[model samples]
Every structure is written in structure tokens, then in C-alpha cells.
Target: MSNSARSLPDVAYVAQPGLSGRLDWVGMDDIQAPVMLVGEDDQPMRFPARVGAFVDLARPDQRGIHMSRLYLHVDQALSTQAVKPALLRTLLDGFLASHRDLSSRALLRIRFDYLVRRRALVSDNAGWKSYPVVLTAKLEGGRFDLELGLEVLYSSTCPASAALARQLIQQRFRADFSTQDLLAREQVAEWLGSEQGICATPHSQRSSAEVKVRLREDVESLPFVDLIDCIESALQTPVQTAVKREDEQAFAGLNGGNLMFCEDAARRMQSALDRDARITDFWLRASHFESLHPHNAVAVASKGVPGGYLGGSTV
Candidate 1:
């Protein structure tokens, strides 16, 4: 076959004229692309990410966006370099440059599961934990903005339930022991070692906190580990990966010490984010998948800055 005969003509994308209407955003989503990112160890790691690429249709007369160009540029950029605010800005520049007169703003969102090895509490072993993460970048009128979003899972023990359980245990102890028996440590320890000591246990539920932060202009690197560390430290009971007997005991102690409701979790996260200089603004939602109730309990908090995140806004 002749080489010229194999050439396919590009028609719809090249010659077709779309309806004359300005679009707020236009481009592709769920595009699978290989991306390089900084890991917890401050080393470059590669992962497959689901990406959404877009640019605003500022010119109504323009036929359509060059979607293939956007895809190609993003694919190339992500494949070759680690994703950062500066690199994302460059990618947006390429997006606008490809569209020329058709677009004035560009945006990109990438979602992936970030894996971090976590050491077990009071144990020598460690295991991998996966965190859902999303990175968003926007470029408009020569200005760029970046946002980072992630979720951390933890255990939330209801304080009210704990207090109620403690009361029940005290009643049981009084009923089981005479006043003289209560004075003997051996008798008291024997009774406490039995299952009757904890006749009623406080209700604990798995909880998650979804957090989004707007990055400051001077932030050069993605602070994934730092942000996760801050959140985990504030919460004080991140879901464990590996569990030994000692680890489980330590985790139980942590749960007992850090009993909280959804509102408490939200406030803790808000305070932690407020102290972070790299974050200009933050939105946090703490959800408790209640074991005692059929529905989940949720609380939301933000930096409360004007024109920042509003209540109940999706990250």
C-alpha cells in the first residue's frame, strides 16, 4: 500500500463549526495518565491517575476546543515531570497556548490513591495505608491557584456513650461486691480482670475527615505528608494498618484518651489547618459512620474567610 493512501483525513475535529455559545468549561475527564509525585519519603513515585482537563470557551465564535491537544500536552507533561504547583501552572499555560483565542482560563484535576507505609502503634511491624487524594489547578488571567484534597480515616468513640458505660460498670461493680470486698485490692483486681468489669462498652465508630486546602502562592512543593501528619496528629487515632496485640492495646488506649464527636473532630482539624502557613484557606468535613445510629453524623468547618469556602461546599 502506498504511504499517501494510508493517510486519514481529520474532518469533524478540524473543519466542523460548533454552535455559537460561550462555554464556562470544556474538555475531557476520567482520562488515565501516568503521573509522578513526591511520596512520603520525599522521593519521586509514579502512579496512574484519573485526570480532568479543561479550558474555558471565552470566544463564542470559536468552533470548539482542541481536546486532543490538551490530552497530548497533559500526558506528556505528567509523564515526564513530578506534579507540583509550578508544573501545573506550566500545564495550564500549555492548555491556553494550544487553544489560543478560544480560551482564557484552564483547569486540571487529578485523583489517585496515595500509599504510605505506617508503623503499627507499639509494634515493630508496619503496613501500607492508602489515602484518597486529589489535586486541582486553575489558571485565569495570568493568575494561578492550587488546591489539595485528601481524606483520613480514624476511630471515634462517643464521649456520651463512654460516660454512660462507665456508670453502668460502676453499678455492676457495686452490685457484685460488698463494702469489705471493695477495700481489698486482690478482690477488686480479680473482679476487674473478669468480663463483668466491662459489662457495657462505649460505642466506637469508624470515621473519616475530608479536608481541602488552598495553597499559598509561595508553596513550591506538595505537602502531602505534612498535611496528613497534621491531621492524624490532631485526631490522635488514625485507623491502623497492622495490628498486633500490643498495637491493638495501644490503639484502644488512644481511643479511650481521644474520645470525640464529629463536631470535635471538625474543630480539631480547623485548628490544625489554621496554624499551617502553607495553607491560605481550608474546608473540613468530619463524618462518623455511627454504629449506634442508622445514619451518619457529620460536621463541617472552614477558615471563615470571606469569598473562601462556604458551608456545605463540595471539595
Candidate 2:
């Protein structure tokens, strides 16, 4: 080491007058970093993540924290190892250790696009879909907490619209065949195949479900794919990728069968999440971007656990 570099004075050690106050959180946000994550298939993949690292400034007299130490720890821990509960705990421990008495609570948030290959509804072709995901870890008062968040897109067909469309079709059929009695089977079949037979179609819109779950501390793995599967199973109309004619037809069938309002969608999600034992608490919001109206339809739900998410509408 150069003698000149060692002789440089550090200003953080010299507390200026009127600068002694504690901060709730002190660190950096929107830091670009790479992290290795294990997917549902147990494959390790590297993803670019936007990271936020912070520590509470517990010591009132301290001027500031060692921001570089937090950044370096995050970079070293995430870049080298696959992200999980244990690794996150160690990273938070490092933050508190580096700051010593200056901080107590440490929190880390990583946001990334989790890519998964999805198959068409009834075709051999498949394509990749990117889901926006966030993983958060917090350590405070000798306790560790972890939360996972995800967003899934699907199709939502209004049930009232479907019923109304069916009524319209029935009325059209009555008007077309009112004067004819004992119609030929082939003639009726031809009329049913025509566009005039099924004129009115129900309104369906692309919808999104945003969910956040607090996992039990003993949980070993991140359940990103499991949560996605549960949501898709309940909704049964996830937006498709790499569609063929048959696949599109099948998707249409599924949407037609699984007609739901935003409230029904939210209830389905709530019921599914309630059955998962690993999740201690959860909150979800189902949003339907309405095609008939300019406004969107939305429903929100929560696990309603004591000392947990309080059923807030935001997701």
C-alpha cells in the first residue's frame, strides 16, 4: 500500500456539528447486479437484478454508514452463489457486522424478470415467458423475514357478458326460424355454422394477478413456479405463447368455460393460497382491464393472519 493513500483523512470519523441523527434506513437502491437463481426445474440460471440494500442507522451519534461495504457484500454474495434463504441471511449478517454499532436492521430487495418456457395449449411448439418477480429479505431484532412477489397475466371473460351474448344468440335463432316448422337437420346445422348464428360475442380482456407471500422461515426453496401453477390452475386461462390454430381454439374454449368476474378470480386465488401450507401470509390483487368500459375491474384479498398483511388493495 502507498504511504500517501494510508495517510488520507476520513471525514466520516469526524462528525460535523448538527449532523448527529439516526436514520430509519440508510443504503442504496437501483444497484445493477447479477444473481444466480434456481428455477422450478432445479436448474441454476443467472439473471440481471435491480438490488436495494439497506441498514437502519440505530446509533444516533453516528454520522453515516459504510455504504461501500453493503454494496460489496451484496455483489460478492449474490454474484457467486445461488440466492436462497441461508445465503440472504448471511448477506444481512455481513451488513450488520460491517456497520458494527451503527446499524441493527438490514433489508435486501432484488427485482428481476424470471423467464420460463411455456408450451402452447394443444401444440408441440413452446416459447419463453418473462414474469416480473421480486424477492425480499429482512433481518431485524435477531429475526429474519423473507417475502416473494410475482405477477401473472391471464384472460378474464365477464360472466354477465357471456350470459347476455347467449341471450342475443338465442333471440337470433328464434327470429331466423320463427316461420319454419319441422326444419331439416342439415339446414339447421348449416345455419348454426354460419356467422349469423353466433353474432354476439362476450367481452374478454387480458388480466393480471399480482401476489405477495410471506414464506415460513423454515422453507428451503423459493416456490415461484408452484405459486404460478396454483394461480394458473385456479384461473385456467393464462395468456399463451407460441400459439397454433388448434391451440388458439383450445384457449378460446378454456376462456369460455372459465368465465369469471374480478371478484370470482380473487376468491379463486384466495382459496388456492389458503391451501398452501408453506405460506404464512399472503395478499393478492386481481385486475381485469375491461374491454367494454374504460375503467378496470379489480378485487383484492389477503390471508387475514394476525400481525400480517391487512388486506390492503394494493398489490
Flag clash pairs in model 2: none
lDDT tens readout by residue for model 2, 16-120: 526667789989999999989887667799999999999998877777888989999999998899988899989999999998878889999999998888988
Q: Where does the lowest 10-residue lDDT sum fall in candidate 1?
A: 9-18
lDDT of each: 0.90, 0.92
Candidate 2 Cα outliers beyond 4 Å, as residue runs: 1-6, 17-19, 313-315
Give the count of colliding residue pairs in each prediction: 0, 0
- Candidate No. with top TM-score: 2
lDDT of 1 at 293: 80
Worst 10 residues of 2 by lDDT: 10-19
**TM-scores, all models, native as reference:** 0.93, 0.95
Tens digits of lDDT, candidate 1, 254-287 = 9999999999999999999999998988999999
Which structure among the candidates has the greatest lDDT? 2
Total colliding residue pairs, candidate 1: 0
TM-score of structure candidate 2: 0.95
